[model samples]
Target: MHNILSVSELSKTYDSRFQALKRINLDIRRGEIFALLGPNGAGKTTLISIICGIVKASEGSVRVDGHDIVADYRAARAMIGLVPQELTTDAFESVWATVSFSRGLFGKPANPAYIEKILRELSLWNKKDSKIITLSGGMKRRLLIAKALSHEPEILFLDEPTAGVDVNLRRDMWQLVRSLQATGVTIILTTHYIDEAEEMADRIGVISKGEIILVDEKAELMRKLGKKQMTLQLQTTLERIPPALAAYQLELASDGNELIYTFDAQGERTGIVALLKELNDADIVFKDLHTTQSSLEDIFVSLVKEEK
Candidate 1:
C-alpha cells in the first residue's frame, strides 16, 4: 500500500485571518477507503478542497498520485473526482446529458457504453432521459455519483455522500463504494455519520480545530482507544464500596445493586482474576457478570470533546 494522495504542512488562511487549516500532514493509501471524521468547523472540507484543487492553500503543498497539485494541476486533477455535498446540478439537463458532459470536462473521449454501465450500476439507467429536477432526492444523489464516475477517475472524493438519503439508498451507496474499491479506485470521504465511517472505512482519520488528531486502521484505533467494561450484578444491594476494595477503583451503580469495572481493551492483562479474588475476600457476592467494549462513535465523540 503506497500513498495515492499526500498533504504536507498544508495551511489555509482566509483574508489574512480565520485559519481554516493548520500545518496538516496526511497520506491516503492507494486502494483504501479512508474516512475523514470531524465536527462542524473542523476543516474536513477545507482539507478536501485543497486536495481536489477547489481551493488553494495559502501555505504548504499537496500531491496527488505523485504529481504536485500546484505544479501539475491538470495531470493531478485529472485523476480525481469530487461529489460535493450540495446538489449543484443543472435542473433541466437529462441524466444522460449531465453525466456525459462531466466526462468531456476531463478531456476524455465519449464512451456511451461506460456512461450506460455506471448509470445502470447506480440504478439510474431507466432515468437517463429524465430531467434532473424530476428525480427524487435519492435519485439525485445517485445521479451525482454517476456523474462523478463519468470521467473514470482513479480517486473519488465523496463529501457527505449520503447526507439526506434513505436507509436503502445508503446501503446501496456502501455496496457501490465497495464495488469501486474492488476496482482499485481509492476513495476518500468526509462524513458526519460516524456509523458510515465505522461501517465503511478501512482507515479512519480524526481532524479537529484545523489539525490532524489521529489516523490509524479502524480496528487498531478502536482497540487502542476503546475501553472494556465489566458489570457485576451484586446479589445484595450495598450503600457504598468497601474501603478495603478501594484499590480496585470500582464504581457502584444501579443504586448500589451493581458495580462497574473499566480497563484498557488493548492491555495484555485485564486483572479480572485478581479483582474477582479481591471481591471474594471483601465478602462481595455477584449474581452475574458481563462485559462490553467501546464503540467507534464513543471514541470519536470523546476525541473531539477532548480537543475542544
Candidate 2:
C-alpha cells in the first residue's frame, strides 16, 4: 500500500527550550491501522497534535495524501478526524445537534441520513436527543467518536481512544474502527494499552525521548525482538546449577526445583536439544517443561527501559 501520510524531519520544541520531538521521518500506509507506542512525555501526543494542525512544528513538514499541512492546511485538515484524549463537548447541546454541528464546521452539507447512521452504529440513537452533560463517561466517549466521524474524514486519529472506557465500549469502538477501515479510512492511534495495539495494529512505531526508535510490521517486529523462555520443573531440588550448564545461562527458580532458559525463537538454532542432553549428562532430570514467548508489552517495556 502507498503512504497516505508523510512526516519528514519533524521536530518540536517548547518556549522553555525543551524539545519534545527530534528530527523524525515516518510514512503511514493508506488504509492501515498504525499504532504509535511510547511512554509518557515521549512525544506521541506532540507528534499527533502537529499532524492534526493543533500545534505548530518547530522544524519539519507533514503531508496528508500529498497535501502539505502548512501550504494546504484546509485540504490536509479536512481529510483527517481526531478523537482527542480529553472528553470535551458542549454540555447543554443535544447529541444530534453537536454531531451535526461538527459536520457543518467542515463545510459539509446537511445529511441527516448519514448522521442517523453513525448514531445507530454507536448505540446512541436512543439518546440522540439527550444533552451531552447527561451522558455517562462511556456514552460521552462514544459521542466524541461520532463527532470525529461526522465529516466522513478519510484519515482518523484516535489518541488514547479507549483509555478510561468499559470493556463493552472498548469492544464496540474497535468494531466500529474495523468497519471504518473497511470503508477505506486510514487509522492512526496512540494507545497506552499494548494489548490493543498487539491485537489490532498492522504496523507498529515506537518512539522514545523525542526520537523514532523503531518502526516495523507487527509480525516481523515480534519475530525479531521477541524472546522465548523454557521452564523445566526439576525432579530434584539443588542449591545451584551445575558448572557444565553455565554456558546455557539458565536461571534456577522455585527454590532450585526449576530451571529457566531464555532463547531467541527466530535464531537459526535455539540450543534446546543440546541443553536437554547436557542436563541429562549432569543428572538433572526435569519432570515437566513449558515454554512462553514474550508479548508485545514485554518488548515495549524493555525498549523504553533501554532508552532510560
Candidate 3:
C-alpha cells in the first residue's frame, strides 16, 4: 500500500489564464492499477504530462519514488514510462531499434535481452525488424507499450491506450495489462472507456473541471452509488399503474407489458416482498422478473453531470 507517486497542491495555468488543474492532490499506490477518469478538458492529460516531465506545473510539486520531479528530474523521469494518447513514432524506424533507442534516451545501457523480452511479451517479436509504418494500428500500439517497458520502469502511464482499437485488440491489451501487473508494475491510466477502468483498476479516481473530485475502490464506489432495477414482465398489460403501488414509483414499459422498479441497492430494505404481496392483491401477475445493478459508466456519467 506504499505510495509510488505523489502529487501535492498541483495546479496548472496557461498564458491565457486557463487553469488546467486546480490544487490536485493524488497518491498512486505501489503495484496497483489506478484509473483516472474524467471528461475532456478535465486535466487528465495535463496531470499525466506533468508527472512525465512533459509539462511543468504552475504551482505545487510531484514526487516519483521519493524523487522530486523538478529537483531530481533525471531520477524521477527515469522511473516512469508514458504511452501517450497519440501514436507518435518514427515511421521509418524498426520496432527493435525504436524500443532499444527509447531505453538509451533514459541513459539506460543497451540491454538487448531486456528489449527482446518486452517485444516478445507485447507480441511484437515477429515484427521486430518491421518498420513502424508497416505495422497495423494494433501492432503500433503494442510497440508503444514495448518502448515504454524497454527501460524497465516501475510505473507505466497509458493514456487512452485502447481508444480506437477493435474489441479483440482491447481484450488482448487487457490481458497484457494484467501480466504487467503480475510483474509488480504500478499502472496509472487515463481512459474515456469506463468499462476498461471497471475491469482493470483496483481503485478509481474522478476529476472534474481540473480538480480531483472523488477517489475510491471500484467495487466500493459502485456499491455506495449504484442502484438496482427490477423489470417485471407482466402477464397482463395494464393501461396504468394501480394507486396502491404509488409508493414504488414504478414505470410502465413495453407498452405496459413490463413494470420497472428502481431501488437503492444499499437500502436497509428493498421492499421486494411488499411489492410482490401488493401485486398479488392487485391480481397482477408477472411472467418473469430480472434485476440489474448500475454499471461503472452510469456512475461516471452521473458524477460528471453533477460537476457540471
Best by TM-score: 1
What is the Å distance of residue 128 in model 3 from its true position?
1.9
**Candidate 3's residue-wise lDDT over 171-243, tens digit each?**
9999999999999999999999999999999999999999999999998999888888989999999999999
Give one digit per residue, the lDDT tens place, for model 1 in 131-248. Answer: 9999999999998888889999999999999998888989999999999999999999999889999999999999999999999999999889998889999999999999987877
Global lDDT of each model?
A: 0.93, 0.94, 0.93
RMSD of 1: 1.1
Q: Among all windows of ten consecutive residues in candidate 2, which has the lowest summed lDDT?
A: 264-273
Runs in model 3 deviating more than 4 A are 281-283
Q: Per-residue lDDT tens digits of candidate 2, residues 1-308?
A: 89999999999999959999999999999999999999999999999999999999999999999999999999999999999988677799999999999999999999999999999999999999999999999989889899999999999999999998888888888888899899999999999999999988999999999999999999999999999989999999989988999998999995988999999865526599889889998988899999999999999999999999
lDDT-superior candidate, 1 or 3: 3
Candidate structures ordered by lDDT, highest first: 2, 3, 1
TM-score of every model versus the real structure: 0.97, 0.96, 0.94
By TM-score, is 1 or 3 better?
1
Question: Local error of candidate 1 at 111, Å?
Answer: 0.5
Instruction: Kindly indicate the candidate among 1 and 2 with the higher TM-score.
Output: 1
- For candidate 2, the TM-score is 0.96
lDDT of 2 at 210: 95
